[model samples]
Structure formats: C-alpha cells, structure tokens
Target: MSDPTSPIGWGIQLAKLWTSSGQTFPVRVKDIALEVTKARFPEPVGCVIPHGISGIDGMLSKRQKKKDWCISYDETVTVPGRINFTIAHELGHFLLHRQQRDTFQCGQLQMLEYDSPESRRIEAQANTFASYLLMPRNDFDAQVDGHELSFELLGHCAERYETSLTATALKWLEFTTEAAMLVVADHDEFICWTYCSQAARRIGAYKPPGEMLPAGVLEEIRSKALDARKFRRVAPGVWHPSEEAIESVIVSDQFEQMIFLVRFPFALSVDHEEEPESDAFSDLAEKIQGLR
Candidate 1:
C-alpha cells in the first residue's frame, strides 16, 4: 500500500485488494469496514448496525465505555443501494476522521457535496471514498465502454454496483466523454441539484437549484408519464442559450424525485465563465440544526 492517506488513495488501495482477492461485484462494504479497522487499530469498528435516526443517512461514534467505534445506518433507508453506500461512507469517516472527531453524522445532501469551494472537506472526502470504493474506476469504465450514456444504461450500472441510480450517474459524470448533465428535482418540481460532466461544464451546461423545470420539457415529461422511452431534442433557448440538447426523464417513486439526463450536441465554442458557488455550508448547517 502506497500510504493510502487520502480518501481516493484509501479507496483505490482497498478496491484493488478486493479485486485481487477475487471478490465479486457490489463490494461488501460491511466486511471491508471491519477488516480495515481490525488491521489498523486496536479499537476497530465493533459494530455496523441499523438505527432509526431521522433526517440523516448514517453515523459513526466512539463507544461509551470503551475505545471501540460503532457505525450506524438509517433503518428507514430500505433501498439496498442507499444502505450500502451509507455504510461505506461511515467507514470512510472511521478511517479518516476518528482521531480528530468523536462522531460523524452524514445526510444524503451532505454526501453529494464534493470538489466545491463551499463543500465540507471531511464530508466530501468520505463521499469520494465511498464512491471510489464501491465503484472502482477501472471496472466502472469497463462496464461503460460500449454503452450509450442513458438512464437505462446507468440503471444497469447501478444494479451491478448495488448503488443508487443517482450515485451511478454521478460516478459516470466524473469521467464521461459526453457533454451531459444530471439534474435532480424535488417532488415539487424545483431543481434541487445538478452534476455536470467535464464536457458539459466546458460549454457551461449547468443549472442552479430552486429553478423550475425547463419550459416545454416539463409538459413533454408529464405527457409521457416519465417513461424515458425517447429523448426529445430541446431547442437551444430551453436548457442553454447557444446549445441544443436531447433530454430524458425518470421518476423515482421511492425517493419522490425526478431525474433529468440531458446531453448536448457538440459545441462549436466554449464558455470561460464560471458559476458562483452556493452557500453550501450554511445550507447544510440549516439541515442539520434540528439534530443539535
């Protein structure tokens, strides 16, 4: 091991070990968590269990009377993908931040915060660790080699990795060659968040939260009942001023969210301007304030 100190470094090291050991798809994070802690610390993780915590995905805390640690995930998270990722996330905190802090509580929104000026460093690191550990880059790329970037394809990847579709799409965006953006909307139809691929960001294909669904696209989606059977060529003026995009939507009943996957036609020129960062810390603080 090449001193796997950072999140990505540890993720890579563990992922390689898992692969070398002939472990199959959808890495069993629970086993890895225990194995890792036991090898590195006398106070290894004593338990990875469930809790009925509200408004949070997972937590890691020191034992009350002992030096050991406990990792607890939300019992209400029925989705296997979400549950698996939450366990991996808590393990990341145990490995990286246990010496610095007594506990860590993470929410879904906080897990998605990464590579931004407003992102919490440790939270972002844990997220990166979970992503890389759960979905190793080499295997993920191999899975994506011949597939078109679509919800159907990403859904398959999600199944293979035992991760949520959102997480899979975000992982794809991390290294995709296509100019695409993944926009997630709350049940009320407001754009709650978005992640853009490198190609998309180069052409300034990004949207801010709190915006309504793009004009006309919403009506089309509603008419189709969010089937995702075909992509509609939305005109330049809809999603972006200078580019046209093909759009598709998937409605997730479990999460009560709408996911829009948009791919732009190749751009003739690029935008050098950048989007301003949101008050992410303040927003996260407000969300977790009730717990305090």
Candidate 2:
C-alpha cells in the first residue's frame, strides 16, 4: 500500500506500478484501485463512523488538533469497486488536504469534478488522484489510439474504467487528438456542462449554440437527425468559423440525459502542433511526481 500523504504522489506511484505490470488502460485503473485499497487499509474503512455524519457515499474526518483519522462510507453502496473509489478519494484528502479541514462531505458531482479548479483545490486533487490511480495513461492511450469518436467507443472505455460515461469522456478528452467537444444537458434544454478537447479549444469552439449556432440549434432543427451510432457532418459555419466542417452525434440513454460529441473539420493541419498529448495521463503523472 502506498502512503496517502500526497494524493497526487501516491496516484502517480500507483500508476507506475500498474504500467510496469503491463495492464491495459481503463482496465488497469480498476486493477490498481482495488489493489491499492486492499493493501493499504484492509479492514472495511467504510465502517468507521463519526458523530453528526449524515447519509453519504463517503466521509473523511480527523479529531481536532490530533492526527487520529477516520474514513467511512454509506453501507448501502458499499460494493468493493465503489468502496475502492471512495477509499481512494478519502485517502486523497488525508494526504493532500488534511491541513485545510478536518472533514469533507462528498457527493457524486463533487467527486466527479475532482480535476477542475473551480471546486476546492483539495477536492479536485483527490478526484485527480482517484482518476489517475484507477486509469493509468498507457492503458487509456492504447484504448483510444486509432479509435474513432463515437458513443459506443466511449461507453466501452467507461465500462473498462469502471466509471460513468461522463467520466470516461472527460478522461478521453484529456488525450484525444481530434477536435472534439462533449456537452451534457438535461431534457429542459439547460446545459449542465461542457468539455472541449485541446484542439477544439484552440479553434475557439464552444457549446450552448450562442454566437456560433442559433439557440435551439440542436433541439429544434436537428433533433430528428441525431443518431448515437453515426456521425452527421454539417456545413461550415454551423459549429465554428473556419472553412472546416462540423460533425455531431448525440448519445441518449433512456432517461433523456444526452451526451453530444461534436467534431470539427481537420483543416489547418499546420495547427496540428498544438494537438493534445498522446498520453492524457502524462500531465497528471508529471504533476504527481513533481509533488513527490
């Protein structure tokens, strides 16, 4: 078991261990997560309870002015895999942010946004730890390499990583070379959030259909054309300014939660120099190792 004193540090070390073992991307992440948790805190770390704690997937706490620590989770969702991620998250807090606070209350979204800066830096660090520890870069790169942008492929990566579709997509965007963007939205037409790949960002591409496309661009006019299995290329200026074109595919589960993958034309090959890194996990690895 690696020390959790620095979540990023431990995550990088664990990623190296998994890579050396020849595990595949997404899959290696789950393997490393399970192995690290069982080795470090063998007892069900989810059982230790503290006062005033309400229902939640996981909790982290330390007594005032003392090094005494505790980590626990809701017994309801206490499967080994979920427990693994929870423990990893708590370990992140223990190693990275224990000085800032005695406890943290984590919901699903908070845990998902573990890499973003808007969230508490510590929380983001913890999430980054969990993500990197679970999905090592080498493995993720192999799965994504030579793969086309599609919902089915993303779903496969998600299952392999034992994470949600959004998580997998977010991770994929970290490494993909194509100009792609992911949009998550509800039935009411309100945009929940959006993430763009490095290429897409450099081209000044964004979602929500403002200034780029008229409002109701996706829902009103093109709703009938959306198909998760295939890509539809629209005319230039539909998604951005270049003579480059746009292709979009919509992924809808039964609940009406939608994931839109929009692809930009591959023109301006000169700008290829700014393409995203081949290994999405490398930046995180560098950050973690630097911390150590």
In candidate 2, list every pair of residues with a backbone clash. Answer: 5-95, 25-139, 25-140, 29-134, 114-124
| Candidates in order: C-alpha RMSD to true structure | 4.6, 6.9
What are the TM-scores, per candidate, against the unseen true structure?
A: 0.85, 0.68
Q: State the lDDT of candidate 1 residue by residue for 1-292, as single tens digits.
A: 4447888888889899899999998999999888877887889998899888886789899997877999998878766588888888889888888888888877765664434444466776777788888899899999889766778888888898888887788788877778888888878888877777767878878888889988777777667666766677888978887898888888878767888999985565465566453222223333222110
Give the TM-score (vs. native) of candidate 2: 0.68
In order, what lDDT does every prediction score?
0.77, 0.58
Inter-residue clash pairs, candidate 1: none
- Please state the error at residue 168 of candidate 2 in Å: 1.0
Local accuracy of candidate 2 as per-residue lDDT tens digits, 245-288 = 45555645454555667777574533545443433322333222
lDDT of 1 at 252: 74
